[model samples]
Target: MGGLLLVAITGIALVVGISVGIGDLPIPLATTFSAVTNRMGWTAIELNRIHETVIWDYRLSRALVAVFCGAGLALSGAILQSLLRNPLAEPYVLGISAGASTGTVAVVILGLGAGTISLSAGAFAGAFAAFCFVALLSNGARGGPDRTILAGVAASQLFNAATSYIVTTAGNAQQARDVMFWLLGSFGGVRWPEFALVSVVVGFGLIACLLHARMLDAFAFGDETAASLGINVGRAKLALFALTAMMTATIVSMVGTIGFVGLVVPHAARFLVGPLHVRLLPACAFTGAIFMVLADIASRALIPQQVLPIGVVTALVGVPFFCLILYRYQRVS
Candidate 1:
């Protein structure tokens, strides 16, 4: 397990550095290291000023945000799967992503809040609204996971219809184009602020989830079993659901919706580290960070002079894994 962790960490570090080094104006791997060391005051090495600025000001922050986003989403998925006892559940299963789209559309297409509300803020508000709606429909803390998921499905359909109506009737070509790009996900505009916010959310969220690892294990046997085992089923589900929502909302607001990391990484990590959340959670985090960074890298590098959506890259990888899981499921059935 320790060796596996070391490998995951090393893989993350390596890809992160590579992400920093590859771009329109490529920097050497050595220069990327030099920039890091120099900034950290570990070395007084002279470097090209342009390289230093790009490395520090833009790419590094984007990569770090991707790291946190990936970890947060993956951690959220693990929690959802455990709490709901549904292997197919993921971060966006609660309609958070659809709510975010509606929020972005309201801001960008419908011209709500004018200049007062940033896209991220609007999206967060919309996401929270969706969560509240779900809670209400499902009877909040008293609701079962199955009920909550059903509420989420209804919410998703509603928000998605709203978003479609607005886009078709209101937004112009340029506005629609912008919203479409954002919906598919990008790390292009994310910088230090995004990195800082996501790191704090995901970092503390991971710690909180880790503390509840045992309860999550109890949850796997269903709510009644969990209740019989002295776990506060309602409270635990509510707390874990909120945590998952917050993490997912933050990431979606910052980078749009990057799918499949949450869906794919937790399953892959579980395969490697087993179902014990104590070890599985950290494994998911590390694998997610690596997978997202590498996806970001692939997004940039896959097409010459043009970047593909990060979601596309992730889906390319995730779809096969998804199919394999389904195949195994059918075989078991």
Candidate 2:
């Protein structure tokens, strides 16, 4: 686990270096490192002001946003999988992403939130509403994991229909195009403020998950088994579920719906570090951060003069791995 963590750290540094040095106004790795260190007062290296702005103000902030959002999503997936005992469980499976999309589209298309609140605020509210809807349905079914999953699917379909209606009718062609782009995910305008918010939120999320790591381990078995082990099964499930929902909602609000990180990273981490949440959770965060940073870089560099959606890059990379996991699971079963 320690070795894996070290490797992950090294990989993150290398990726960040590459990301900082890529793009239209490319900078050297040495200049990128020196610019960063100069900001920290570690070294005084003369860099062009335009290069500094491009590297520090834009590219670096975008990279940080990817790191935080990726870590948050992966951590959320890990917790959900453990709590529900479902290998396929993910951060946005409960319609949180759909709800966020609906709210953002409403704000963007209908101008519902014209002045008072921002689109992200609307998204957070919508995501919470979706989670509450799922909770109500699951509770009526006696709060089992299977019931929760079914309720989530129902809620997702409902929210998705609402989103489609808003986009098709209320929005014009350009508005629809923008909404679709957002839904597919991009980090185009990410700056220090968004990065700071995500950093704090994802940091708290990681701490909360770490604090409850043992409860998650217990949850991996049946709820009865967890209860027999003196864990408050109901309370733990609710806490973990809410934690994941909040984390996922925050990320989707900031960056729209980037898929596959949440779905695929936890499984990959588990493969590396095993199922113990103590080691598994951090590993997921680290691996997911790296995956997302690389994906963001690919989104920029894949085609000349055209940027692809971050979600598209992730899905392209993740789909084959996802199929492999499913195939292996079936074979083992």
Candidate 3:
């Protein structure tokens, strides 16, 4: 546990430093530290203002957003898999990201909540709406893991179609392009405010998951087993589902729909450690954070002149793993 924590902390710091150095302006490592410490009042080191702005204002925030989003999504995936007893389960599998994108697009195009509410709030509402709809749909006699997955698929399709329609009909060419970039995922314009919200939400979600780790483990065996252990199977499942949805919605609001971090990171963590949620949870968060920060850096560094959507980079990395998981599932079934 201590070793893993050390690695996670060091990995985040190292990636943030490397990402800060990789941008167009190219700040040095020492200047990066000096800028950070100077801001924190821990050092009086003098640094160039332009470099400081680039590091503090742009690169650092972007990296931190990636860290928070990655951590949240991956942790959400871990919880959902345990709750559903489905290894293929993920944050996107329940349509949370699709719903969030739809809500954000509505705010961006239809002028919904133009005066008061921010786009993130709208996105969270949209995600919550979708989650409730799924739960309701899956509440009948046919409700089970398979039924829930089908319900989620239906919800996802519905939300995705709505998002596409809004983007096409309501937005102009430039606006449409921007919306697509967001739907596909981009950390391009992340600032401190977005990072702060994401950090707080992800932190809260992680702590909650940690507190309920044992219940989650019981869930892996199904509702009956969990109930036998004095766990309120129904209530616990709903709580976890809501928490995961909130985490996903918060991240999707900030970084757009970053796919595959949730789907892939938990599996990788399981392979590294084991299936215990107590160990698996932190492992997933750390691995996901590292994966996302690296993916964000790759999104810029892969093309010398152009920045690719983060979704593309993660997809390129995750597709093979997705295929392998599918193959294994087929074999097992």
Q: Which candidate has the highest lDDT of all?
A: 3
Give TM-scores for every candidate, taking all chains together and pairing residue i with residue i: 0.89, 0.90, 0.94
TM-score of 1: 0.89
Residue pairs with backbone overlap in model 3: none
Give Cα-based local distance difference scores for all models.
0.83, 0.83, 0.86
The global Cα lDDT (0 to 1) of model 2 is 0.83
Q: Which sections of candidate 2 miss by over 4 Å?
A: 1-4, 111-118, 132-154
Model 3: lDDT of residue 97: 82
What is the lDDT for 175 in model 1? 69
Best by TM-score: 3
lDDT of 3 by residue, 202-231 (tens): 999999999999999998887788899999
Q: Which TM-score value belongs to model 2? A: 0.90
Query: Which regions of candidate 1 are displaced past 4 Å?
Result: 1-5, 107-121, 128-157
Candidates 1 and 3 compared by lDDT, better number: 3
Candidate 3, TM-score vs. the true structure?
A: 0.94
